[model samples]
Target chain A: MTMIVKKTTQLIAGLIFLYGIYVIIHGHLTPGGGFAGGVIIAGSFILLILAFGSDFLRLTREEAGSTLYENLAILIVVFLAVSGLLATGKIFFLNWIPKGTPGELVSAGILPLYNIFVGIEVAASVLTIFLALVIFKEELAE
Target chain B: METAICIIAGLMIIGALYAIHAKDLLSAVIACGIVGYGLVICFLLLKAPDLAIVQIVVETITLIIMVAVVLDSSREEHFVKPDGKGYMSMAAAVVMTAVLLYFFILAVGMLDPFGSGSLRMASQYINGAVELTGSVNLVTGVVFDFRGYDTLGEATILVTAVLGVITILRLKGRK
Candidate 1:
């Protein structure tokens, strides 16, 4: 709540966000995947809220924007899975793209894409819930 | 390793007991978080890094969400005096705990030694995951490829939960 705390949060939030993206992208090779990374990303935003209050972060967008973003991410995931099924003509979620060499970033067909999409959906949903709680608390206090 | 695990498990039990018995709701929530972190340590000791990662993050978020809930409501827990019926229920709980612990120990002993399981399914995944999924991490390969449909189901559940929260929390003209 202090100025020092806000400054420190601002300094570290970027790094935390970057680390979340790294975890999400390198999920295939690392222990952390979409869910974990997404939580971390949401945690960074939570830290911002704690340090500066929700009013400061509410300038970006309202709760509806976050819900829309989450829905879009889930829609992308479903579309990808269905397109894979249609392309392969075998089964849903089939890996139709060419499997690149293992250990490479682009090796896992659809896996990384799925991870990214899930990460987005998770992050958006969590932030939305958090913001909603904050707004509700404010309303109750009023 | 066994001794370390035993110590962690002991701490976990202590944390859980404190969480259940703490008078202050905030302290109880914090104690639950301690138990969650202790389980994460147990997962790491068991060589399940993926589970550990997921557990740690999920535990943190769960703690945050619970704390938010507690913050919005009363902080003091009303203690109920146990009557004769409560004593009987407590006795039954103690017996259940003892029985469950005995069965758990017996099952642990019956399990194959660590790193020595010869399950056919595990072997196939270890041997074929990279070739089949083009991912070096067999866990990821299995989760996102071999069991992609299951992952889809999980994602759907998450979306459903988000929608449910939105619907329940929606306030008129308060976008």
Candidate 2:
């Protein structure tokens, strides 16, 4: 990869990730939600990997073990949702906490928590998908 | 109502037929991709982004897998499928798409004799999220909420796909 392509992809990926955060936060008011935003963020990270080199991404993902993160994400979501049910019986998965304030970053209840979880899951899963793909070809030519 | 679906369905079928009839199969794959995109538009109009996203992702994977298979096989003597499509099969495909589209439009359109759905159960979760959970993101609130089971199921599907592929292609060597 030339310096130009590397710089370009990194720039694009960074924009995508920032947009993802914007969407995740204002998700309540916008048509785009956590899932879509999360995907976009993951796409940004993927771009970063493509621009730089798989070596670093591999090191990062290897240390994390995407599968573990994916499983944990599922468990965390389930646990969080169930906790709401047990406490208030508020129709399972209900926020069950205080609305806090409305505009502040931490105003909403469970919104931020799930957003973070989704962010992690999306980052790991998208990388895992690509990692699995590269496995098809024993080695990536630089 | 039914007329528009018929036209859309007709165009889809024509694209597919042309795709198949074309000498090169790669063009046909692209044609199918276009058709898939059209179907996604229809799904969106019906107000189900979930279905639309799922269809697009699934088709993308399918296309990738197909391309991979073709690439692997192209190295060999040749690659092929059924000799040709019978006239009946073509007719059946068009008719089925049209019929299904008609029913779907009718179901989702303003013709649902009854007013908007009760949505009471849905409200319990959506409204509850903001009031109690303090969560600003509703999609997450619901997904991670009581309906978290379905999300887990989706994750399981991914795991299964990975495991299945790993098993099919042993670590010994590339197939």
Candidate 3:
């Protein structure tokens, strides 16, 4: 990668990641929810990696942590689902949290929570896929 | 809106054909990306901003990954001239495509015209949805609260796919 690419990525990647978080946080009021926001987040990381080169992340070691986060995020999502049943004892994925006023940041109750965790899971999973492929290619070259 | 979508669909078909016929692998991949982005335009025209956002980002990432692979491996695609057997296969493909197109037209004719679907199931979610789920976005409420099980299934499928990719690509299986 060139110095120009690296500098441009440094300037742009953070903004892209922040936009992804914004989309996830506003999922209740917005069109993009977990999946779209998460992918955007992953796209930022992928851009960073492509510009900086795989060696910047030390991907082989970081790969384990990425997988761990991916699994943990999904587990949290499932836990939230089951908690709906255990807490309310009414139904699975019940919106048990008290609904605040609609259109506000904190209004969506369990929906925003679901979006955040799902966003994390998706972001982690997608990054892991890219990292795996890049690392495999690196290893093959070696 | 219909005119815009129709134009985009035409462009998508052209892009698809070029992708299939292009000898340069990288150019073919980019042509495929044109089709994907054209669908994003169609999504926006249809008023599904959520789908459009997702499609555009996913399409970009897919393009990047494909370009990376093609650049590292090979730039040119090997093309073989069609023989008699190939011509036979091509004829079969043409017939199959015609039959599929006929069925597609039939299916499209049966569908409810755009913007006036019977909201038999969705009516419940639409009425008092903001109050019931406290999300102004009815789609989010339906997806995460009313139909959380389906979202869970979708997430699980993604996880399983990533798991499979990791398993296949990992440098070592056992320590």
Most TM-score-accurate candidate: 3
* Superposed Cα deviation of residue A61, candidate 3 (Å): 1.6
Give the 10-residue window scoring lowest on summed lDDT in candidate 1 chain B.
B166-175
Of 2 and 3, the candidate ahead on lDDT is 3
Question: Which one wins on DockQ?
Answer: 3
Query: At residue B34, what lDDT does model 1 achieve?
Result: 83
lDDT of 3 by residue, B1-175 (tens): 7888888899999999999999899999999998999999888888889889989989999999999999999898887899999999999999999999999999989889888866687777778788888999887888898888899999999999998998898775635
Chain A TM-scores, all candidates? 0.93, 0.76, 0.96
Where is model 1 more than 4 Å wrong at Cα? A56-60, B98-109, B173-175
lDDT of 1: 0.85
Model 2 stretches astray by more than 4 angstroms: A1-4, A49-64, A85-94, A101-108, A139-142, B1-26, B39-146, B163-175
- Residue B93 C-alpha lDDT in model 2: 92
**Model 1 lDDT tens row, A1-142:** 8999999999999999999999999998878888888888988988888788767236236677888988999899999889887896868888888888888888788788888999998898888888877776676665
Which residue pairs does candidate 3 place in steric collision?
none
> In angstroms, how far off is A53's CA in candidate 3?
1.1
Instruction: Indicate the DockQ of the complex predicted as candidate 2.
Output: 0.30
DockQ per model, Cα: 0.72, 0.30, 0.85
TM-score of chain A of 2: 0.76
lDDT of 2 at A47: 63
| Candidate scoring better on lDDT of 1 and 2 | 1
